[model samples]
Target: MQSSSFLAAILFFISAAFASDSVHKYQPDDAVDLWVNKVGPFRNPQETYNYYSLPFCHPSGDAAHKRRGLGEVLGGNELIDSQIDIKFQKPVGKTTICEIELDEAQVMQFKEAIDRDYLFEFFMDDLPLWGYVGDFHSKRKGDNQHMLFTHKSITVKYNKNHIIEVRLTQQNPKPLEVGRKLDMTYSVRWIPTNITFARRFDVYLDYPFFESQIHWFSIYNSLMMMFLAGLVSTILMRTLRNDYAKYAREDDDLETLERDASEESGWKLVHGDVFRTPFSIALLSALVGTGAQLAMLILLVILFAPVGMLYIGRGAIVTTFIVCYAFTSFISGYVSGGMYSQHGGKNWIKSMILTASLFPFMCFGIGFILNTVAIFYGSLAAIPFGTMVVVFVIWAFVSFPLALLGSVVGRNWSGAPNNPCRIKTIPRPIPEKNWYLKPSVVSIVGGLLPFGSVSIEMYFVFTSFWNYRVYYTYGFMLLIFLILLIVTVCVTIIGTYFLLNVENYHWQWTSFCSAASTSVYVFLYSIYYYCMKTTMSGFFQTSFYFGHTLMFCLGLGILCGATGYLGSNLFVRRIYRNIKCD
Candidate 1:
């Protein structure tokens, strides 16, 4: 038995050595370049030329394409040397071999996409081909040693004229998982590669129904807005007419006047302190200013998206956003500082600083955490250190200073008006509120109408961001945005009216919070989408996704809150100024 065991071990060792020799580890003398073409969905059955290549794995050909200028790309002009060339191609008879290394995070991303069975259609020189990435496999060579690699095959055929046609076919559709290695290696090959494809291109349109759905949603949202607006207008007119009529009937008898004063009810009673500066006016102003800036930013981006001006490059929208935000810093400062001064605030500088930095700080802090995680995971998605430094410089010098300048100008530009109502020296006792009338209840309920107006459209936006679907329906988005604003204003006004009728003078913050609650629903919907719709896994993707979502929700909150406050402010001022109060 011992002799037999020794012979078996020796035989196993020899076999292991032979098996290991068959597969050699790849070593490239120069940088390995992989070309990633435009990614599209399989369901879209068009000719597939409309998809633009992603810039992450840009090749030498892109440089030449950009040199032709934006007009050539945007104006439907001639194709300007945009095809990526495969320089490493060998003789048609010999199999071409190359090693591609992917970071662990990237592998995880690919795995997530593949696990969902997303078929990305690829285009080469206008020839459309489709494929899905498969699982990573490890084969035991011998002696407990294993070789790891992912396999994919692309078949090509050559005609009599040597014109080549490439066909993409799935070899093994196994689910992929990230291994222990920080970088995963894959061996790719073109099997039976007859030869190259002669240059010919065609344009294909897909997702035709996507545009139609946007139009339908826009109309639905507009109808909802109109309903809410009409309801609020009717209620406000009736209530205001009654209040004015009652006030118009003067009670000249001193005893009757005293009784009426003692029994005073409705908004007229709180007129003395309704416009009194809310607690922490600085923070309130800052929020309003930030909200205004974000609202404008969103509107401008939506307007420009369909025009193809903002999406110039892979990161061009981000760059445009940053630059525009910096320039728009003045709007935040001016709005916040002006409103604060008008409300008799003393700390204009504090309000301005908070206006400029509060939202940005939240965004940066979350981004830093996400970027750090990406870096630790060896993901190329992380922003480079130098780029972060440049961003800081721009924020500090450009955005911050412009905000300060705007604040100074606003503070100096004085045209103070006498307050519509005189504040009483002693504070009136607030009545005990019912459970349903509490601020918390009001806020949650007030957000519903506004949220409902955009909920359907929000799904598409989320899917576009995470599911990698191309979104190009800005016209519909713009209409939805307007409808959302309308709903927010009308709902907030109704809520403010109720609070005032109850003699609650603290409508300033409540008005903002109530409308801003739409963001809360938005965040909740995002959580639901992540749990139910997406196949994304891994700690890095989760953290990045939530962090960004939080920032987005916060921006939405700001925009809605600001819109509510401005609308309420106008309504309150106009009504109070017109009323005759003794």
Candidate 2:
């Protein structure tokens, strides 16, 4: 019965999610509802507050509010019915909404909002309309005056019965002064259009900007890099084959073999030490596992987004991401457990705990800081306590248990060590090499190609998130992601080979860091983007921008690091498999 009840609940949620996307058809003279969504400064996209937060006239007695979905609520949307009367095909002209008696406090509030360039958002038939709260005027005396717009003109376009577009214009600006009687008025006009409902969102998409020549050129450049990487891999494979032939020859006499052994000065000499356990094996395993899970999570989202049209809904992407991350926690635990065991780690509990909590705790810490800032500023960006509790419950009940189960299964199934060569009891001392051959140098230089592969796409992504541009190019994103993975793997393998050639057995962390350094370049590029592209100001906006970028870079680092380490691991194993350790 319990299992049945759980299944029913899952089905109900799925149905609800899909139901939100259902098309709405209307009849003539049907009542139309206007929803007041949010208000915020135009410069900062994430800094938002409830529409009713300002000193505006409230609806009389038990105003109706829209019931939001999980994603909508998480997105800081608190939509309330504006209680304005309208008909689907009918128009209303020059109607008064309310009369406001502007006292000292009301005048001050309007002045502050106007100074900040605040804008309000309203929704009619799921179509959005934005208008400024007020305006600032400069006099000949060089003094600025704040003025409030007391009139709203709404124009709605429709195709047959479906709403295609909604526009709002604010007018009738009056100086903000005490003892003023301000009359708030509104007018609604309905126009017919030939546009289909499917194409209603076309106006919001910046096609020319997204599909610019530079975007295509970046894809071409990445393709060229991939070809170069493939060439490098071919050359490396040939060299390894020659080395194997020389080392595996059985016809050579004892003296000849001894001479060859003495002459062997490269990667072959470090075979026994290459597979030795790395420092903090538990932590490394946990990071790699978490990275694997994140990689899979991103891939799944990219695949699902286009089909589901996730971009059309408010906060849908974030909701999908959270759900996918929870379910995918099992992958992290399995990978971490198997890796830790293979490294001969004894404390399974520590590995499991780290694997489960490392990424979550990191995000929570960052979120705590951001949330505190939001609360202090009284912005809607601050997540509510109820929402936080729901997230926690999902993680604790669903994610944690699945991860624990996966760890136990992985330990039992694939935990045994399978290194090509046996580890020696005595540790091998790494000799001094050229400055370029040093691990630090290799790690820093190795990330250049990988960063170049995805830098162009990063601009588009940043614009979508920060500049309020709608992102509908999931196909392009999918291609860039594949290119990044390929480039990271090839670059890290080459870096690992160089490290081994210098008789360095500690290539494990070096390879990971080599690929992970791509995030450093990305973060630096974000700083450039913030300065050159955006007009955003104030301490709150700056903190949120850097904080969010930091979190993104950390995830990207983990994903790239894991991809590089796994690829290098395969290369090392395959090369050593043919040559005898004995």
Predicted candidate 1 versus true structure: per-residue lDDT over 316-408, tens digit per residue: 456667878888888888888888888888877678788889988988988888777766754445566656777788889999998887777
Clash pairs, model 2 backbone? none
Q: In model 1, which runs have C-alpha deviations exceeding 4 angstroms?
A: 1-131, 135-206, 212-215, 251-255, 309-312, 414-417
- Could you tell me every candidate's TM-score relative to the true structure? 0.72, 0.93
lDDT of 2 at 488: 97
TM-score of 1: 0.72
Note the residue pairs that clash in candidate 1: none
**lDDT for residue 133 in candidate 1, whole number 0-100:** 43
Worst 10 residues of 1 by lDDT: 23-32
Best by TM-score: 2
For each candidate, the alpha-carbon lDDT, in order, equals 0.65, 0.88
Instruction: Give candidate 2's total backbone clashes.
Output: 0
Error of 1 at 327 (Å): 1.0
